[model samples]
Target: MVDTATNRVALVTGGSGGIGRVVSERLARDGMAVAVHYAGNEAGADEVVGGIASAGGRAMTVGGDVADERAMAEAFDAVEQGFGGVDVVVHTAGRMVLGPLTDFDLDDLDGMIRTNIRGTFVVDQLAARRVREGGAIVNFSSSVVKLAMPTYAPYAATKGAVDAVGLILARELRGRDITVNAVAPGPTATPLFLDGKDEETIGHLSKMAPLERLGTPDDVAEAVAFLAGPARWVNGQVVYANGGIV
Candidate 1:
């Protein structure tokens, strides 16, 4: 009972904000029906869905904690019921906490692991099953995994795990014609980057890269689009969209 005219469908977890928002909207504009997945930001997700629909693209918002299996299942069901099976899945939902290893709070570690690692596992498992053949899976890793920044040990650990999981997933899906890849972004100009930092600190961090500026959500989205669309031969690789901040 789905609309066969739109063969491309996408589920963008955390699509309510920042890089997720931009990426989801970009995919919709590219002619994919997008499911804007959000944890607790129903209004934000709705805004993204509304924007896409207003622009003559098909989109809908579904709310759930990405780390929760039951919640994620419901979200996926909404997508399947609303727009048929998924063709692409972009996992942009993750938790980022900063602390040195010595000072790493177990609670923070637990939360981040659940959201970043467990959440990705659940989403990827379902997406890999639901997405049609020749579809693409994009998971979010972090530049911190390569940069090894101080106070980001715990956060980086989670992303490092993401990198490994994504690569192995690519191999597991062999012959299915599905590609699994990870996008590791450096300090980008997203709300997550601005949360607790002042202007001067942010500027310094931005200049740390050779590009002399922080990345934009659109910049990351472009990389995701390439992997999702035409980079069929690219599989099991972490495309660092960090503007050379490695």
Candidate 2:
């Protein structure tokens, strides 16, 4: 068992699937007591927790909507009550709505704003107030903001807001020794990226990067783990984990 004094406790929002799942597992392997947060995916969260346990790591599942302040407050309380204190918070929970700027459905845009923009605000508010000194707050953004891909305008706008939040929060927490940063991943092989695309489209995107391949969940998780653990000097930055695609 890892020593409690040295083991940090992390609460990863949207920790049940895709890149979030890999991030939760990576943090656990790094000797953190991970609280895997999920929304309407208890089974997936359980599987994540079980995987961590099976690997001789400590983890638990927490459920709530990321945009709900009361629910997220209680979720934070649960993590603190369970593991003593929170040292890292990875806000990976988000929603994506693809459409052109002119014809984008207002309803879909509203939903994305609630989950991606409002959700980041709610989670960051708690993390800023609660996360221990020397801890880190890593928010998920997207390289699409830089790429300016078609049909991704709304989604990119949400991430642009996230990037702004991360940079501002880092300065806001100036004396706390905590680092706030955002990870903007590109063309990752997650359900969020692959769901509606055809094989031909996927293949084309996969080769857009200089690496000539789609980034895996683990690829992005490695960057998050770095920011969460050892990358202390890296703050208020958006580190794009997109294989030089930007």
| Cα misplacement distance, residue 30 of candidate 1 (Å) | 0.7
Q: Worst ten-residue run, lDDT, model 2?
A: 1-10
lDDT of 2 by residue, 87-143 (tens): 999999999878889988999999999999999999999999999988999999999
Each candidate structure's TM-score, on Cα atoms with residue i matched to residue i, is 0.96, 0.97
- Please give the CA lDDT of all the candidate structures: 0.90, 0.93
Candidate 1 stretches with Cα past 4 Å from truth are 1-6
lDDT of 1 by residue, 39-89 (tens): 989999999999999999999988898888889999989999999788899
Candidate 2: which stretches are off by over 4 Å?
1-6
In TM-score terms, candidate 2 sits at: 0.97
